[model samples]
Target: MSAIGGPCDRALWYGFRWASPKRFDAATLKRFADGHQTEAVAIARLKACDQLEVYDLSPDTGRQFGFEDHHGHFRGHMDGVILGLLQAPKTWHVLEIKAVSDAKFRELEKAVEKVGEKLALREWSETYYAQAVLYMDYADLDRHYCVVCTPGCRRWMAVRTERDKPEAGRLRGRAQTIIASDSPPPRISEAPDYYQCRWCDHAPVCHQGEQALSHCRTCLHSTPVEGGEWHCARWARKISVEEQREGCPAHLYIPGLVPGEQVDAGPDWVEYRLPDGSVWRDGGAAYTIGDTIEAEAYRHAA
Candidate 1:
């Protein structure tokens, strides 16, 4: 659900397929840590508010309020459930906390003041707004409240969004469709310099980087099945997470993911002619592919 709201369909597909391992640097790691601490501070402050009751954890299960679909393959977790806001004391609002830069905070305030919370929220960040709606639908709530703060917790603002069942339903269908797809979806941009693609993690393979981590999720034989399970047709069994990470000798890459054009194929192998005039083969085959350094390196490492 967190990724469902992203701009690129292909990026989301790549993520679901485990096309790339997510790697974050030290600065990014620190920022994530700081964000969590800020959320905690903000939650504590919210708890101090006399006008609202914050259920940070689900009273029903004594855990975070979480919901899922497609047999738990698609899931979402809320920041909390908010009750007793003075604006609508009887209504329950799904709570979402966000930490943004000070500049962004000011811009958000202006947008909210100009067009109101719901519209401002949709414009502020489609990702967050999309997530909020799904959260509302799963939680069986109609309203969502957002508490926005700065990194240092020096400034605060709130925005509220109403549930759109039709929109949420569409998003849910989108998620299910992507989850069931045997191949990746279309790219959002063709250019490497496109703003959304610039910092994307999948850029390497998506744009020409040859190496993709070998895993069941990236293999041709694996398919996402009903009941939140992954099945490997090659082995004729359910694939555990460990098995997915450590693919077998019979593993084959999804042809589309490779940079070359498919020139020959058979039950055992699919061959390609890479741009450098070298042949590459994914599985055991009689035809020889010359100089598959990348493939050799990956398979060797795997």
Candidate 2:
């Protein structure tokens, strides 16, 4: 399969709500690796104690649980499952670990005190709640033990969450929607300057009409070969699934890959006519598909 299993909060959240092509910069990648290391350290400390029976799923061959649908296009993986805890009854529970900054931890602490851990988590981040629910459902567990720790602070909190079947079903349906459909879900907002959109890595591509599909697997320049191999038309080279997911700057959306009517085209740029009759320009340096640019500017540029 071209798509790898998504079990983390970020992947699941993006898959279900916004399946934009992810572009992880070096800083983001380093942050992820550091967070994983922090989690490993915390888990190791927990494993050394007698209060809990922790299972490590960080190893490549470790025991993990996952589910696939839509011909393995939609999938999820759990970090690990635990059976013992000092405060809880002896029953299986999903063990989820997260390392947050001290500032975030303080905010979480206040939220936990105000509304309780379960509700606080949902308020703090919907992605975390959705990930927990998916893990519970796929791992056949009814409870979740989410461990949150701060770097350099030995203190940590274990928050318990129960399975929410209704939410899980909704998320599952969303995942299926992404896998079965050609286009990604609508952008969170039409305005390029939207706060969320600004922070998102996919902002450049998601807002641009340069490519019909931002991902390599769906790009026009790429063709899937046997044995899950992909050949790039532009480079005439083989591409791996990992490389496809982390798209390059050279990504060009195939024409008609996006669900829209083409209204204009140039030697390097293509414009899709929007519902409001404004042209969405693709393949330009300053103008992108979803970005709000002046009509006169688009006309002059086109």
Candidate 3:
């Protein structure tokens, strides 16, 4: 099985339990990393502006602000906070920076122009709106300044937003539901060939159900500590929430973890017969075994 990352794995925004868990292929991961690098440059330029006093919160070891829910299960990290801007003076605002493609930037710009910033953000990008609201609520700020930029362009757009208590509360409830449940939430569709599922990184495991015991928190070897800490018996050490969420290569599912009849068993692998007559394989790296069927079929036809 693929290694899990950290507590952020189970974040509501990542849509792991609600949608499918994100599995980043090399190209996708590279693109994500490149976006962050570009955003870093943009932030540096923003900091250089004498009119603004930017407080950087992205650093791992710094004066960063975060929030943990009552159970300490949900966590969020703010990007930064800004003190002054030409539009909003003498007021502190949560700073959210996003680097989008030229096309996406144009879309956002047009939406803002046509329907206004608040309505356009809700209609165009619910994710961004939710993120901004969550940060605003956690940082105890009423106003937010979102900075959107393009990769190769110095031009940027700034949109201001107010605190959205209702939306933030809804998101908090959704996060709690994900953390409390053992079974995953229902898929967006029942069909395997659904468009979103086809492109999802977690498609392979999501469709397989219990066969993919990849989450460390779900593994029997992991035990919860007092403050949402996870201890892995296999590793014999306390693992951070992120480490627990991102399971290790040595992960092993507890016996009878999957609720199905065992059809075949081997030293390192077991196949179970599901109610739908589909076979679910549980073992080391077995989750990826049948993932290349389409590619193989294409090769044979060619």
Q: 116-228, model 2: which lDDT tens digit per residue?
A: 86677666667778888877877778988888888633668878888889988887776666544434446667887888767765555566543323566655566545543
**By lDDT, who's the top model here?**
1
Question: Model 2, residue 199: what's the lDDT?
Answer: 73
Query: How does candidate 2 fare on TM-score?
Result: 0.67
Pairs that collide, model 3: 1-285, 4-246, 4-247, 5-246, 6-242, 7-241, 7-242
Candidate 3, residue 114: Cα displacement in angstroms equals 3.2
Cα RMSD for predicted model 3? 10.0
Cα misplacement distance, residue 240 of candidate 3 (Å) = 5.6
Per-residue alpha-carbon lDDT of candidate 1 for residues 1-302, written as tens digits (9 for 90 to 100): 98898888888889988899888899988878878888899999989999879999988899989888987789889999999988899999999999887888998988898888778888788888889999999989999999999985788889889998998998898898889888778889899999888889999889866568888988999998877789888656787788788876667888778888899987668899988999998887532233355434434442
Question: On a 0 to 100 scale, what is the lDDT of residue 168 in model 2?
Answer: 81
* Residue 273 of model 2, lDDT score: 78
Judged by lDDT against the true structure, how good is candidate 3?
0.65
List, in order, the clash count of every candidate structure: 0, 5, 7
1 against 2, candidate with superior TM-score:
1
**What TM-score would every model get versus the actual structure?**
0.90, 0.67, 0.69
Worst ten in a row by lDDT for model 3: 1-10
